[model samples]
Target: MNFELFIARGILSKDKNNFSRPIVRISIISISLGLAVMILSLAITTGFKDAISQKVIGFGSHIKITSFDLNKSFESSPVDMQQPFYPSLADSTGIRHIQVFATKSGLVKSEDQIQGIVMKGIWSDFDRSFFAKNIVEGDLITIDPEKRTNDILISKRIADKLEFNL
Candidate 1:
């Protein structure tokens, strides 16, 4: 009744030189396939977890309080940055920080060159750590809440194509 005991006692031992039994071959193949699948699943899952973690961290914070007009469109509805929950969120536990943001997209034309670009506006409280890490060139200048700023950060690729000199 105990197959494991028989195998352990060498009573049902398999001959290594002779693999003529169909059941033995099938069992070995099945075990190998199972192990391969498990290993592959583990590897893929770990890789996915790592990639998703990096993207979530790299793209900035976990939650964004954008407008409800986000119906699969890039354009977001305008909303007042000041909200009642702002005070509660700041006072609540688990929340690291809160920042305000706005974005608009349009086409820029310069003589013969025309390019589409999206402009993102962030409040003075915005975290610049992510931007700092990704900035290929140019020192990041903080947007003074009161002062008018024309300062903009662009990707190196865009700068080169736009023939930007600074």
Candidate 2:
């Protein structure tokens, strides 16, 4: 037998009760635990990234077309839906669909408290599938082309703070 093989066999023999035996067992266990932890961390990080990405895309679409103004605020400048590019965007390659939306920053006042909020306005053509999966309590709002409605949807956090519910 080779010198390395002979030495390795002597070190790993079951009859030996030397310091190296405990050290070898501990090293194997430590390596196994480290690998397990790494795998778990990777899985958790991937799931967290996917969840956060879905929430962000749910709040706003993948792409937004707005006026090229220099205004620095959460509210975006309005874009005309009658633009020539608006229709072509839906038919373009790698594009799934197009939607028109608007946002306005405002304040909501309760009997004893006032809170700032940004209101997002969507039309009938806006896709509600993303939100349908996330509605915690009530149904989605219905918009009529011939009439205006006073219905609004609020998050649970905001509802608790403003003392509002369905």
Candidate 3:
């Protein structure tokens, strides 16, 4: 029994191309297929993870600065962009760039079409790269601190319903 066990282990571990038994060849083929399947699965899962993460984080940043209020919804008061802690916060480890943003609920009306929409106000400092990558239609709005732009991006569903010209 010991000899047989040693022989079986040696057969599997040998680097030679000539396999003595059909069972050993079958086992090697099975292992190769299993490894290929595992690699394919890993690649597919990683791709999906990256895509979902981009979509989720594209809407908001990892850290948010907001007012301390009981109102949990988006109706909370805005936080002052110029804060005393900004200097320390920027110097802190793991901290990167900071951008000021605001939001207000409003209705967009055009002729006979009226739609309730959440107007997101972003400054020139706001990162547009994320939106540029994930945007399905139209181009990313070029924002300038010195100048204002009329460029607006809306969803196709809204555009279709509103009968938008551009």
> Where does the lowest 10-residue lDDT sum fall in candidate 3?
12-21
Error of 2 at 139 (Å): 1.7
Q: After superposition, how far is residue 58 of candidate 3 from its true place, in Å?
A: 3.1
TM-score of each candidate structure, all chains considered together: 0.64, 0.87, 0.65
* Candidate 2 C-alpha lDDT tens digits along 1-166: 9998898788878888887888877887999999999999999999999999999988887888788888989797778779877777888899876877889999988898788999988888878888899989899999887898877888888888998766
Task: State the lDDT of candidate 3 residue by residue for 58-106, as single tens digits.
Answer: 7777788888989866666977767889778878888666788777777
C-alpha lDDT of all candidate models, in order: 0.76, 0.86, 0.79
- Give the better candidate number (1 or 2) by TM-score: 2
C-alpha positional error of residue 46 in candidate 2 after TM-score superposition, expressed in Å: 0.8
Q: Flag regions of model 1 displaced more than 4 Å.
A: 1-41, 69-73, 108-113, 156-166
Pitting candidate 2 against candidate 3, the one with the higher lDDT is 2
Clashes of each: 0, 0, 0
Count backbone overlaps in model 3.
0
Better of 2 and 3 by TM-score: 2
